[model samples]
Target: MADAHRPDKDKEQDAVRHPAELVAFSKVKAGDTVIDVWPGKGYWSRLFSPVVGAKGKVYAYVPAEIVDMKSDPMGIAKAFAAEPGYGNIEAISDPLAQQPPPDMQNKFDVVWTFENYHDLHDSFMKGASVDGFNQAVFKLLKPGGYYIIVDHAAAKGQGLKNTEDLHRIEEATVKAEVEKAGFVLDEESKLLASTTDDHTLKVFDPAVKGKTDRFMLRFRKPAK
Candidate 1:
């Protein structure tokens, strides 16, 4: 279920705040198959639905553990099922450690992760490590498919050190890890950059909650 504290309407608007511009730059078009990983509150999922249109498909991939934590997982999934223009949309809750469903393998033109990469460390504590998550993303895309990530940025030298505490990761660390999965960094966008986010407070700290410094990375699965 959507977090009661985070209404669907608010979540929808927040999706428009920064990531929408990045998505536009991604050149996503009608008839493209897209996946929104860790689709918290279904914001990106909702956005992708219309962008993909009737002929295309959008899969909202939520980790199985999220569902196991509450009874509303299926309820949240069902909400998307009830939308009118989202006939091609689907909700998939697979264990984070596993690959995306076989039916989805090599099926997407784009896979997007937003404001959620830092949680990979948390996902690890739950048994699925970051490597597992990246590998799954790698396997789900076509050879030339796009994998886009946007997440809170840790201090330059912090590396992955405070990922668990601050829910942030070094951009360099993320770049290296994704490259190891055979993805090539295609582009970087500075639209979300903020010099004022001093990298000390937790992202959720009231002062910097909405304006946390972040890095945007676009990578592609190499074509054979």
Candidate 2:
């Protein structure tokens, strides 16, 4: 039987260009409070809303620094706020690296970033520097909560060396940085791996666009 709390298969598939089946197979679950960091257009935010169910909450954290960018961050937040069946979701537009609001401290079960990790290095997002952002994620989760990241992959050894110019970061660099923030690298998924990408074009470049090679990483806060 289909899981009562899970989203309909078609609804999930229609939401994103990538195969939703592969994404849904990752370890997110119902009744888990989730944070979707920098949710561009709220695609993953929407997918997570139903999957986490009524008992769970999804917080769409949009860093305040970039909230006024040409990308229309406020419009995205407004759209998410107006969506149905997502009463538990909220959009927070705070400056990056600051602590989440008091009520949210140490309260989330999962904190996720999809395709936006590289933005941490962007000049406009300085307040949410890589280290500060990671630290905030660590502080927001429960002891055993999850930190999930999916991002475009630069060539191995790049070490975020070209993140500003190329907008991709080495997977090893991401793992090292997150591990340094105190999470245990629990698992990895190859569902989004693609070799056809030449690693030269920007992720938004029309050439490779939606098929850019990406790394899917899952980390867990160690239970104390």
Candidate 3:
């Protein structure tokens, strides 16, 4: 958690993002292969690299739809991977609507996405099927592998109503969609919940921006 190489700006977010605690809850360890889905700026990937150590691997999965954006997420990931102390990291991308490549199937110990899960339901994703994305995550993990999602929480009973406008999704809605992919809901954490945010404003709204109420869930692929 105190890695000196991490950017000061990224470290400043530790209070709200809780990268250290999230890493521990995810159960990532040395020698475990991890896939970081939609790793904008390689935030989580950077955290995973050192924990996974020399033998372990971290693949930053950049959705094909956003690879060519002005920000060039793929380029950022690739460059970060090449820097000293981050050799274990690699950058990978696939069409948002497609499953992972055959070689990637059942290969990762953990598949993680943070603050971006609701984007899957938004048009910005270019019609990517939420179900298909969940299935792909399921396919990417080895048996008993964990899939972790940390996203802004919507008002109760709203389902997908606020996704596009508010950038949030009902917690139950996410659970239902993911469970449909055959994962078992293993645990959840209130680590990012907020008392001030009323779940009505967009996550980007200045008042609620970084302090939005969020949910963290851990789902496990069955070992059988």
Candidate 4:
């Protein structure tokens, strides 16, 4: 994390984001292939690229729905991948459907998305099936590979009710949905949790914007 090439702006948020601990928890190691789904601003991508090393690869996937948007997320991803010392990183786009391409199935060591799982349930994604998404994730990983999700926590039992409006989802809902896809719940972390976050306000509300009560979950595909 002390690498000089990282943007100063990204470094500033490390204290709260706990990139090192989360990376360790994910067990991403040198020579492992990783897919950083919907890697906005390339924050996690930047960290993963170095950890995965020259022999490793990091795919910064931009969902198909927003690939053509005015913001040009694909372009942003490409630009980040092209920066110095990031040769191991590449930018990939989602296919027309939310599901990953057939060639990508069973090909990765880790599939990780940070703070954007709730967006998959939002209308902006054009009704992408969360179940299909989870199943696709299951198929994408190699046996024993990891699936990591980090997102803001909503009130317990709220389920998808706050996903669109508050940009949060119930912790239990995520666990149930992902587990249905056949992943075993490996571990959960409170690294990003905030006791002061009452789980009522929108994640974007000024008071909670950067410090929302977030949940981190790790799921694993059985080697068998």
Across residues 1-224, which tens digit of lDDT does each residue of candidate 4 receive?
97777999889989889988999988899999999999888999999998999899999999887787788999999999999989999999875245657897788999999999988888878776778888888888999999999999999989999998899999999999999999999999998999999988998899998999999999999898
lDDT of 1: 0.79
- Give each model a TM-score: 0.87, 0.87, 0.96, 0.96
lDDT of each residue in 3-109, candidate 2, tens digit only:
34334643554534464653464456889888888987776777777788788888888888887889888678667656766687788777677766667677888
Going through the candidates in order, what is the number of backbone clashes in each? 1, 0, 0, 0
After TM-score superposition, the amount by which residue 151's alpha carbon in candidate 4 deviates from its true location, in angstroms, is 0.2
- The TM-score obtained by model 3 is 0.96
Spell out the clash pairs found in candidate 1: 1-72
Q: Which stretches of candidate 1 lie over 4 Å from their true place?
A: 1-16, 71-74, 100-104, 123-125
**Model 3, total clashes:** 0
Cα lDDT for residue 82, model 2?
69
Candidate 1 residue 1 C-alpha distance from true site, Å:
23
Question: Which wins on lDDT, candidate 1 or candidate 2?
Answer: 1
Q: What local distance difference test score does each model get?
A: 0.79, 0.79, 0.90, 0.90
lDDT of 1 by residue, 157-189 (tens): 999887888989999999998998889999998
Clashing pairs in 3: none
* Full candidate order by lDDT, most accurate first: 4, 3, 1, 2
Q: How many clashes show up in model 1?
A: 1
Clashes in model 2: which pairs? none
